[model samples]
Target: MAEKQVQSRYAPDLMAGQVALVTGSGSGMGRATALEMASCGARLALFARRKEPLQETAEMIRAMGGEAFVVPGDTRDEKSVEAAMLKIKAHYGRLDVLVNNAGGQYIAAARDITNKGFEAVIRNNLIGSWQMTRAAADHFMFENGGSIVFVTAISTRTALTGFAHTVAARAGVTGLMKTLAAEWGEYGIRLNCVAPGTIKTEALGRYPIPPEKWHELNRSVLGRMGVAEDVAGTIVFLASRLGSFITGEDVYVDGGETLHMGHDARDMIHPDMFQGRQRGDGKNE
Candidate 1:
């Protein structure tokens, strides 16, 4: 296979006639992916819990001379999601792409997370994917096939601590993608996921940045901290003709961060950065 190229064409004519429904298309990676797809010739149906952001994304698409539709609602709500699907079918009469990217996360220790919190993450991450996949599958099968991309996270595989609930839920989504790919192959439906690492976006501020973690984050990967466009490009590929045969797989867009396993440089740092202090010692004290 050829190495993937990272590129974005504003208001692309490539996706000119294809239709796509992207959940959580209001902001972050979802917003970027929606724009890129629209540029490439895809008509977009943008979804989110809030109307304002969805409208903004749609407007951007329109500005790029691409067609767009704003669908505002909770994707986890099957009724709402199916209604959105119905609207798309009414407007375009065909569904070519589905991107399940709506998800939530909060910082908390595993035991500290409440049942509600855990279930909330699962509902949005896992169940929401199922709902959209089911709706899209029905329409897609009728058309003989389409592509579905799920926005997953690398933390699930690497064992991130504070987001235990999310880790579990997202891992399940990866599993779901694999199974669907197997069963839906004959129908021509392709299912895959983009596992994003740390990408700077609106969500960055919400996650609580501690100082200039940029250096750490930049060095966090062999390349650098990810930008929204990095993941967006991968999404564009998965939804385009470029990814025709690819299915039932997940790509880590984290720039080799996962490869830092036993060789984690943080551990190799001179045991002298804290000369006289023991591990976790409060130097300020």
Candidate 2:
């Protein structure tokens, strides 16, 4: 429930004179990324379905003497995306970076997932993100060249259960980004992904997970729960000039959680399943 502090370890002017567009900037990771990029001195164009939250983000940035333009719209709609891009060009004259941070998913077993539910998640996560990328390229990045960072979930690597739809969509985005990286390279445009794992955000709290279960989730090699700032900083790095040579790389900002998948599941479950033989002891008893 505590508020997340906004602070970037990067130089203040790391992105000075640059214009960046961040989708889903109304709250959570998108807002965090926008704040971080603004702190790094980039002029921001914020997008989301709601205008109030987007304006709140803009106010926060402007309060810090940073510039922000709020353009509320749904990422799933091509017309909305095109209009937002046009507004960005008209207002900022150019866009140097884009953070595709808008996406949604609900937990449900693969078998229980309805056809509509699956398609909805796919539309929000994969199709919408691709549309934004294409629009950005068509409007500004194609000629000016820029950095594109897709905020994907680490579920792809860990293959987390009860969310097959989301996992598949994120995986598809990662694959699309890799292909775009190669194709966009000729234009000096770089495309990459930042995969977050178990980040402590408002969205995670909405899940049916028990409070006690959080402790188990924190068993990452880092021995801590990742905050939105952790993922946001990684995004800023990938979008900044410092990552000039990096492209098509999917960076996992998950505190090594993906690398250690299935470890916590075993710990959380009763050991009786082992039939008196504990795991990792090399005993088949």
Model 2, range 173-211, lDDT digits (tens) per residue? Answer: 999999999999999999999998878888877889986
Model 2 lDDT-worst window of ten: 1-10
Can you give the TM-score per candidate against the true fold? 0.87, 0.90
Q: Cα lDDT for residue 251, model 2?
A: 98
Number of clashes in model 2? 0
Best candidate (score: TM-score) = 2
Q: Candidate 2: misplaced stretches above 4 Å? A: 1-5, 262-285
Q: Which pairs in model 2 have colliding backbones?
A: none
**What's model 1's overall lDDT?**
0.83
Candidate 1 weakest ten by summed lDDT? 1-10
Q: What clash pairs does model 1 have?
A: 11-39, 12-39, 14-40, 15-40, 15-41, 15-42, 16-41
RMSD of 1: 7.4
How accurate locally, in lDDT, is each candidate?
Answer: 0.83, 0.90
Tens-digit lDDT track for model 1 on 1-285? 122232465445666679888989988999889888977888898889999988888878777677898878787998998888888888888888999988988899988999999999889889988988898887655466888999999876788889888899899999999999999898888999999987878887776766367547643456668888889889888878888989988999988878775574346864655564545544532
